[model samples]
Target: MGTMVISGTVVLVVLGFGNHTWWLVAVAVLFLYMQYGRSGRVGRGASTSSPGGSGGGASGMTPGSYRAYRDRRDKQARWERRYRREHPMEARRQARERKS
Candidate 1:
């Protein structure tokens, strides 16, 4: 993590001062920063879980579950839309899926 930040900063500094085409360096730095943030290695060490289970990097909540969860959410959204259209009164009466 430290390595990533240091490398990214070095690249940025070089790009700011050097005459070479530093786009690649900038890209590399961005990639490293993203990697670092994704791994939760910035202020703290890499975590076993990410902000969302959708991130394809190394984390918990298997890739299959991520897809399944997304699909379920989409399906739920569709159902909500249909329910609202079919039964506007019920939709206005109470919220579906209570807040947890």
Candidate 2:
């Protein structure tokens, strides 16, 4: 689903470039970003889980566990950003590895 959205966005961008209608590309990108946010694949602050799962509360995570999860996520993101900045080639290689 994500790949399809990305490919569609790329096609829209190409079409917009060819036709001089930049708004088409902008709208496609905006729609993709909104969908990404709604999908919960990149969340912040709290961890989401099934309601009936262990350690889950009404909001899907117990307060303490949620805090821990958020902390870990933040730490990892920070490290990733730093790594990417410091070792761009290595970061790209690792990303390719993970994708495969």
Best by the TM-score measure:
2
Backbone clashes (count) for model 2:
0
Q: Would you list the clashing residue pairs of candidate 1? A: none
Measured by TM-score, how close is model 1 to the native structure? 0.31
Query: Largest lDDT belongs to which candidate?
Result: 2
* Model 1 Cα lDDT, one tens digit per residue, 9-95: 677767766655566667676676676665444534334554465556445444334554776789999999999999998877676
How many residue pairs clash per model?
Answer: 0, 0
lDDT of 1 at 93: 67
Model 2 spans with C-alpha error above 4 angstroms: 22-26, 29-33, 36-47, 54-57, 61-100
What TM-score would every model get versus the actual structure?
0.31, 0.34
CA displacement after TM-score superposition, residue 24 of candidate 2 (Å): 2.8
Model 2: per-residue Cα lDDT over 62-99, one tens digit each:
44455557767999999989999999999999999999
